[model samples]
Target: MEGFPTVELSGRKQHHCAPLCLLHFGPEGKMMPIAIQVQKCKLRCSAELTELLLRRLSQTPGPDCPIFLPSDSEWDWLLAKTWVRYAEFYSHEAIAHLLETHLIAEAFCLAMLRNLPMCHPLYKLLIPHTRYTVQINSIGRAVLLNEGGLSAKGMSLGVEGFAGVMVRALSELTYDSLYLPNDFVDRGVQDLPGYYYRDDSLAVWNALERYVTEMITYYYPCDAAVEGDPELQSWVQEIFKECLLGRESSGFPTCLRTVPELIRYVTIVIYTCSAKHAAVNTGQMEFTAWMPNFPASMRNPPMQAKGLTTLETFMDTLPDVKTTCITLLVLWTLSREPDDRRPLGHFPDIHFVEEAPRRSIEAFRQRLNQISHAIRQRNKCLPIPYYYLDPVLIENSISI
Candidate 1:
């Protein structure tokens, strides 16, 4: 804590000092700075002022080094030197703007990159240039919304930008590029680590697909202004029908042909189940009620209301017929897996309570399995094709 750096900025009538605080332990046990405490400022501190102060402070020998207040002659020279440096560097509009933008972009990209899982190769391959593109794409919706954009319009632009960046990122993934340290590939398939078998890139694509689909379904139906306009409504409907639901649409290239398409579809099932977890958190008990809600006598409900609970109200609120069909098909595909090999771990931040009653937990999993099987049988008569998974490797990639 004492080793941390502090900086003091001086001006005509005031001075401000900020000490960087170590807030959290990062991976590999490195200390990460969480905040800077700035004191006694009349005006808001700009990044330029903070950066200038830091640059000046770093000239000191070490964090333990102390600065003595200047004598009369020394004070005059210091003031003059500071003024000259500010005039030469900070006064230029073009240079200042470029530096500010670069700093903002770089900061955002680095923050995101740091959050990525260390197990994936994509985390290592994520160069600053590519991350900058991802940052732009991630914020494209907010930019559009700032420019008098509608929800549907903003979402469409966001999806388009996200898809473009994703395509470029995915294109970088190859057997050679991913399997680093030639020895990693030389190991037998059985000896290769679980992460190596996991295709993080594909997982990222699956998440992106689910997110985009959910957004489209959520906004396209609710935006009355867009839905009311004939032209806008037509365009929105066309995108929903042709681009998302129709597999034949060339307008929005899914890149499914090049990658394993099974997980892309399977993510819908994962999303549906994951959505229920959110519903539970928000006290939306229409789908499934948390165990805390049940009485002691009825802690174990009937088979119909066992671990998984389904309400007609929630089911009816789902997207249109085509979307629902695809979701069910994905759920069915997932149910076909053996009990132990189910993809429950693929979900984001999901954890089962170890202290929970074993009987109740097993009941819940059984209910989930039953629901998936029932949906599969219900859709068995339809011409819903299955994507084989044995040869298809699953990726564990993430998208912002």
Candidate 2:
């Protein structure tokens, strides 16, 4: 917004936002958004803009912030819903899909390759998750986050604001958030109805935990073995220093102290790379196919005053043709799975050869199949089926 052509629409409303949305479950166990507050960022509220319309120019979003209701005029309701979609697009693509799954998995891939040997047990456990991660992330840096990339030219936030969101989210991120079960429990969404994400993810996490505990116990045997491993210590330290930036407040452990600690950390890495990435990645196209639902950019800023909105003005705020095409093209590229994709729990590679680890892997695969079967049965009765985490559909790593 710093360099936006604010002069072009000086006579009209002078505001920019993507609006925050609050949602709850509907009676039939479906999602229902009740209120959506207009999102405000740093703005240059000029004297030329309306005095009462300063409500739009306000930098702070508060309890009194403007929102839309069902009774709002047709155009106003559309605007509010569009803004809420913008919020989803920004938070979903940038934070959940990109930052959390892709970048974080890249960190684990780098640390393990640098600090651990190919034959090491930890390497055998983690290397499969690193497949195609480097290639995809390299493409992301070159085309997405680079100067004048898709985000800069097409998205409303542009390069600076997108990067700002990334920085702020990273600063606030904690190790607790990465661990599956703890994250749901901490967010108090464990009991939320129609939450297939929580249920499927926790099941995957528990299965991965069982597999990890078995593998680690076979290799290390005791807590003392875990503490005495030099390569393991180095890998953890590298991730703490380089990936987490050594922030003690981040709650990322700098070293492995016990068998349980090692098992939990490794389980987190596996779950994040495989099932978590799939849960967010697979549904991207489904949500973004209709451009208005998750708009790449809104052409006009929001106005506070009622009756100012018209059908023509509403259409004007939508993304132009070029912007929409480029955005949809990029999402399609990122969302689609490749022909050579390996589904979760299906490791065709011969990375782990030892009988004990091989047996654990087989058991893990069986558990994932059971989870998939259960999800299929559950979805038959659900109003909307959730197949995002089905083992047969989920990729083993973030390939796209």
Candidate 3:
């Protein structure tokens, strides 16, 4: 079976390879002409090594030929070959492509492993110069959060450095962003086909908000030792100060706003939900009466989005808020654990899903219709008062 090409690849060999083509060695010492032409001829006898080599070669600069891989054979390898060979293809670009074109659950499993770093050759080819849209997995998000609390000596410093880089990248990316369809495909998902479908202005903003919330919950270090360390504290303070000061600056690129907004949102969410997420950052976290062990049925936290909640309540007041709210909900819904998720499972949809706890779908629809009625009026966008959120904050804090 062969892999196919969707977009043009770099170098002169582009034509020789189809976007979808399979490259496998045939019987004897000779190379088989799969979807891609074999040039290196460094065939490995081990099937595991052969697949790895083939996948890597396919990503290499190819000729001008349109490469085509028969879709039927992507998962056709013998069961015996699955174990040894699967791990080696961890960095295979085709895996992401396969996920976009086929099974989402499988793509999700691969994404959860975090085996492929953003620096992988395929990543460079696919997401070049794009840092605003990060590829996150549960493990990757966990590592960033360090939910285990056992931070070793060198790990904290590495995390801090990475966070610094991310912060700068976020503040530089544009707000009125355009996403190529291939970017979604690279992330192992696809958007609905339409001009408005790929437009992510709302998703970008929601992602920034959610990211900020995550940072507040997970990334901020709170140990006295960490806070006491002048160097580390200085870094945190400097970054935070920069974010606050530059937050509304017109000079800041919309592209980069997502990053800072995410950092800020994370800060607020952590402050609201569990101070522990911000424990390592502020060193002021105290275990309060609100902390308690939640049941397994509720072990996974339900979706929480302030923007979406606000948007829903004031829908009649603002038309743009409808689009923004739905987009926010879509972005928020994607990050929920699969077991706890509703519709808008992985991407955007025309209709919004109700995320409130204990609400029936019909009831949710009625409520949404009421809000839509208000939005249709000439009402203007109004800010959601902060006082009303205290109970929600307390509830979330206790659950954590």
For model 3, residues 43-152, the per-residue Cα lDDT tens digits are 23557554763465443434422222332233221111221121112112112211111122222123322433443321221121111113333433454234331111
TM-score of every model versus the real structure: 0.17, 0.89, 0.20
Question: On residues 1-400, what C-alpha lDDT tens digit does candidate 1 reach at each position?
Answer: 0011112111111111222222445565544333222121222245654465446543222333222222224433232223222122211211221112222224323433444343322222222122223443345346422333222121111223223323323323222321223223454333333231123223333443443344333323444533343432233234334323433322322222212222232233233222211211222122112211211011111111111323432222222333333323322332232232223223233232233322333443454444335444544654542211111211121111
How should the candidates be ordered by TM-score, best one leading?
A: 2, 3, 1
Worst 10-residue lDDT window, candidate 2 = 1-10
| Most lDDT-accurate candidate | 2
Runs off by more than 4 Å, candidate 2: 1-18, 26-28, 44-65
Residue 321 alpha-carbon offset, candidate 2, angstroms: 1.0
Better of 1 and 3 by lDDT: 1
Q: How many backbone clashes can be found in candidate 2? A: 1
Write down the lDDT of every candidate, Cα atoms only.
0.28, 0.80, 0.26
What is the full ranking by lDDT, best candidate first? 2, 1, 3
- Please write out the lDDT profile of model 2 over residues 1-104, one tens digit for every residue: 22132221212333346466677777877677776666454354455433424344534444545676757788877778887787677688878888899988
